[model samples]
Target: MKKLEDSAKRGRPDIVHFALMEALSTPLFLGNKMRVYVHTINDRIIAISDNLRIPKSYFRFEGLMMNLFRDRSVKSDEGTVLMELADGTFTDLLGSIGAGKVIGLSTAGVRSTAEKVAGISRDVENCAFVVGGFPRGHFAQSTTRLLGPVYSISNVGLEAHVVIARLVYECEKLLQEGVDHEGDKERGKIGA
Candidate 1:
C-alpha cells in the first residue's frame, strides 16, 4: 500500500474511518455499516465516519441525516444541506458492503454532472486515501482519511447480482485489454 498523506487539518477533521457495526461477523465491514453522506450548501458530499469510540451525538446526526433522505426532507437551496443513508438501507437496496466518512462538495451552484464529478475528484486530490471513488459502506470502517465516492451499485436487491457480474466482466475485460496492449507493443520491439 502507498503512503497516504493526512487531509485532516487540525482537530481530527470531521470525517473519520472506522469499522462498521455489520463487520463484526465478517472479516470486512459490509452493509451493516452506516454513515452520513453530507452534501454541503456548496454541493459537496462529505462522509462522516464515526465508530463506537466516537460520541453518540455523531450517531444521532447520522440517524437524523438518514431520516431526511428517507422522508424526503431535502429542502432545495438550504445552504449547506446534509443528506444521509444508513448502511443497512444501502445493503437492503444496493447491498453496500462498506463505508467511509468524508464530504464531496461542489463549488458550482448545482449546474452539471461534470461539475459534480469534478468536485468528487477535487475531494480525492485533497485526500489521497480515497479508493474506488464512491462513499463505500464497508471502507468507512477503515481509517479517518477522507475517501472518494464508491462506484455506483444497483439498489434493487436481485439486481445487485447483475451489477456485480457486470463489474467482474469489466474488470476482466480491462485486464485482457491491458495485457493485449502490452503484448502488442513489446512484440514489435527487438531486444538486443
Candidate 2:
C-alpha cells in the first residue's frame, strides 16, 4: 500500500472522459484508469469507485426508485440530504454549502455498457476521478441527462482500476505476511 501511494505520486495519473455518446454501446470506459462524471439531470453529486469489483449486492440500479422513498426521509427541507445505496439502502443528513441549504445523495452501481466494461482494465494504480467543466446550477441536469441514456455503466474502467489498486495493495501485504509466517513455521520446526 505504501509503495502504491508512492508509485501513484511518482507517475501522475491521467483523467479520462466517460462520454455517453460512446459509452452507451460499450461496457467500459477509459483504460484501467478511474473516471468520475456527473449526471446531466441532477448533477448535485459525483459517483466514483471500483466500477467492476463492486458487487451487485452493494449497489443496485433496478430498485432505486422504491428504495428512495422507503429508506430516506427529509430531516430538514432547508438543509436536508439523502444518501442512497445500491442495495436499496439510504441515509438522511443536513448541510449548507453557501449556495443555499442542500441535500446530497450517494449510491454505487454498474455502468450501463460493455464499452464501459472494457474501460475497466488493469493499467493505472490509484487515481482520483474528478468532475469539472460544467457551469454552476446546471450540474444536476447534465448528470441526469448523461445517466438517462445508458442503464448504468456498472464497473467501468476507472472503477476497475480502483478495484485493482486495492486488490494489489492487499495482496502485497498478505504476501509479506505469508513470508513472515513461513519463517516462523521454519523456526519452530528447527527448535522442535
> How close to the true structure is residue 169 of candidate 1, measured as C-alpha lDDT?
39
lDDT of 2 at 13: 15
Worst 10 contiguous positions by lDDT, candidate 1: 20-29
TM-score of model 1 (CA atoms): 0.24
lDDT per prediction? Answer: 0.32, 0.30
Distance from true location, Cα of 100 in model 1, Å: 13
- Cα displacement (Å) at residue 184, model 1: 0.5
| Maximum-lDDT candidate | 1
The sequence of per-residue lDDT tens digits that candidate 2 reaches over residues 5-31 is: 223222211111222212222223333
lDDT computed for candidate 2: 0.30
Tens-digit per-residue lDDT, 1-192, candidate 1: 124322222222123222212111221112222232323222334343332222235565466545555754433254343333333322232123233323322221122332233234332322221222222222223322243344333232222223323333343454455568778778975342
